[model samples]
Structures are given as C-alpha cells and as structure tokens.
Target: MRKLRELFRLRFEAKLTTRSIAASLGIGNGTVCDYLGRARVAKLTWPLPAELDDDAALTALLFPEDAKAQAERPEPDWARVHAELKKKGVTKLLLWQEYLEAVPGGYQYSRFCERYGRWLATSSVTLRQEHRAGEKCFVDFSGDGVRVVDAVTGEVRVAKLFVAVLGASNLTYVEPVFSEDVATWVGCHVRAFEYFGGVSEVVVPDNLKAGVTRAHRYEPDLNPTYADLARHYGFAILPARPRRC
Candidate 1:
C-alpha cells in the first residue's frame, strides 16, 4: 500500500513520468500504472510512509482475484547424495530411485538425471582441469597451410601460418608469418594476448623450433624469447613431448 502511495506521489507531486519512475525502480511502466490504479481504487491518501507497505497487504491488493499461492520447492541435499554415489560403483539411476523413495515428492527421473549431471559437473574433478574464465590459452599451427603467390616476385608464401586458440572461450587469433623464428613467434604471442584482452596463466604449445630449443622425450628447453614472453605475461609454457607414430 505504501509503495503504491509512493508511486502515486512520484507520479503526481514529484511530476515524474511513469516510464522514468519504473526505470529507476527496475520495473515495467505498466506495473507502476497498475499500482497507481490499485491505490486510487482503495481510496489511499498521499505521503504514506515506508513501514505501512507490508508485502502481504500489497500482494492482497495487487492480486485480489487470485487464490492459489505460489509453490515453494524444497532445496536438494547434494553433499549427502554425492557422498552416497561415490561409494562402491553406485550409478545415478540407483541414486535417483533412492531419492524418489526417500522424499515424499521429489523430482521425476528426467529432471533428477539432469540435476544430478549438473551437480556432478560442479563437484567432480576430472583428468583435464576445468578451464576457468580467462585462465589459460593454447596455441598451435594448423596441420594444413594455405599458399598464396606473390604477384611481383613470383614467390609462393603460406597465407595461413599459425592459429592461437583460447582454451576457455575457443576464441581464435591467427597471423601469417614467413617463418616460425623466435622473433616472429614471440611477436605472434604478444599480438594474440593483446587480441584476447588479457594474459593467460599458461600457454600449451607443441615442440616447435621457434618456441622449443631442445625437444626431449621428457624435458624440453624453451627458447630465450619464448621464456621472456612468458615472463612478460606472467605465464608458464608446457611443451608436448615428441611422439613416434
């Protein structure tokens, strides 16, 4: 009731438009009009205080025609359920059946499975660490490269050279360079990072000449500029070990 009175006051005494007031209050203009209509019908006076606007009274006035109250759903106990599922090869279907049996009215099988999947995704840690927002980036050259012919010199150069992809958003940054020298590689990394709007925690690269000095089966030495770039970006580099197919 008091909110309606305030809305009315703002409309009449303060001389503010309904749309402006609604925007300020983060509600629709039609909502403000509805409140004003209700206030006028209830024969409300102006200058009503905030304490007089009880939510129950406002709800009764706003929705006098409706009888059914909104349903309040119970919160699920995920910790206990996760603990139960972690033991002895228990499956989600079995847990869902248990949930249906335990609770008087619980989620149906489909909804139960969906909710459980979401819960497992948030709770469990898999082999590959989950990529957080703006955390790490991966850079690699595509296996295939496109060629372009120079019109004047009649020399052929690869048009598509290197492709850098952010691990989190899958945003690609591409550049064409003559060769994968240390300078070109470092410059590419700098341009890619600038394009991404921020630096990533780590850069995962394959054993390439520009970045990796000595590609061993276990430990690989990073090129000097690559290390300097890592220092500039406050990130670490992990080169993939050589594999014989």
Candidate 2:
C-alpha cells in the first residue's frame, strides 16, 4: 500500500514542498524528493491517470529505468573484473562500486555478485579451497635453478627461484636467490609482500628446510627465524604437510 497518489496531490494540487509532503505522509525527506524528481522527469501531472492509480503502475511510469528488462541492462567485463579481483585488497563490493561509477544503474549489488559467480563457474575449473582476498599466500622454491653469470668477475652461480603465489588470485611473485637460507627465505617473503602491496593473513609455505625445521602432519615446526618473521608481519604460518604438496 502506498500514498503515491496523495504524494502527487500534495505536491501539485496542494503546492506542498517535498519536506512538507514527507512530514504529512510520515515518509523520509529523501524519498519524497526522489518521488517528486521522478514525477517531474516523467512529466507526470497532479491528477494521475486512472490506469496509474495502482502504486506499482505509478512507480513503473515514474521510474522507467527500474522497469527496463534485466537482459537490457549493461553487462560487466567478467574477464576484467576477474583479473581485477586477483589484485591484493580487491573485493566484489569495491569492484561493484567502481562498476556503478562507470555504468550507472547497471546492476544491483546482489545481481552483480550472482552474475559474477555464474561467470566464474563457467570460466574455469577452480580449486576447492575458497581463498578470500588477502587471506593466504603460498610460497615455494622451483626445482630447477637458473645459472647466473656475474658481470664483473665472470663467475657462474645457480640462482634458486623463490616463488610466492596468492591463493585467491593466483597472482605470483618470483625472485632469484643463491641459497635457501633463513635470511634468503625471509627476505623473499618480505619482498613478495611489498610486491603484493599488503600481507596476507596466512602464509602457506612448502616445507622448505629454511622455513620449516621439522615437518609433522599435525604440527610442523617452523624455523625460529621464519617464526619471527611471521610474528613481525602478523601472519600465521601454515607449512604444507611433508611430501603432501
């Protein structure tokens, strides 16, 4: 039940302001202003048509944008949105706000989420683990090392690949180091966090000797230095089970 007809009467026939109408009908001032603005835009008069007596019909007439078919609404670039989501600190709500700025009245928040989910389902096979934004980052070393030639001394060294992958976005950060020592390992984590622009809540590291001193199924022992790094960064270390990753 609505007093839309009375609202129109109060504005046009009674020469009342939107605030006055809102006061009379116990409605919000913003709502009264919105209704009046829509009526003005729709070129509606004081005495609405008999057909427009129904609130729904009157609303549809005044707010034609809401009456547009769902299919007619603008669609988001799912690939771009998905890519943007992989960046650290990016969320659906933030992306949706940006989308509204670009395409006003495109889709409501709920519809945007539903459609994005449908797109994700059709796009690729995802891992069962649901990685929330900035939640987990998986770190490991590549098996094969690359040889690096010193510029000045003409010395050859095998550089180990320190790999860090964000669980949610699958965005990766890689660096080359000479060894898997605790200093090198902790340095890689720091640099990876800098690259990602933020630290994840949890760091999932493969049971590297530098990071995990002893690997146990129930409770792996993290290297003291690595544990200190975790404490400094405020992230939990969840070492992958030995031989399981």
lDDT of 1 by residue, 11-109 (tens): 778989989766555456777776678767866665654644665455455455421222333435767777887777687788877777776577777
Model 2: weakest 10-residue lDDT segment is 119-128
Q: What is the lDDT of candidate 1?
A: 0.70
| lDDT for each residue of candidate 2 in 1-245, tens digit (9 for 90 to 100) | 24666677778899998887766766668877877787888888757778886755764687565457444777788889999998877999999999999989888899899768645533443224567989999999986789999999999999999999998899999999998898899999999999999999999998879998888988888899999999999999998877652
Best by TM-score: 2
- C-alpha RMSD of candidate 1: 16.2
Q: What lDDT does each candidate get?
A: 0.70, 0.82
lDDT of 2 at 47: 78
Clashing pairs in 2: none
- The list of candidate 1 runs beyond 4 A from truth reads 1-129
Backbone collisions counted per model: 0, 0
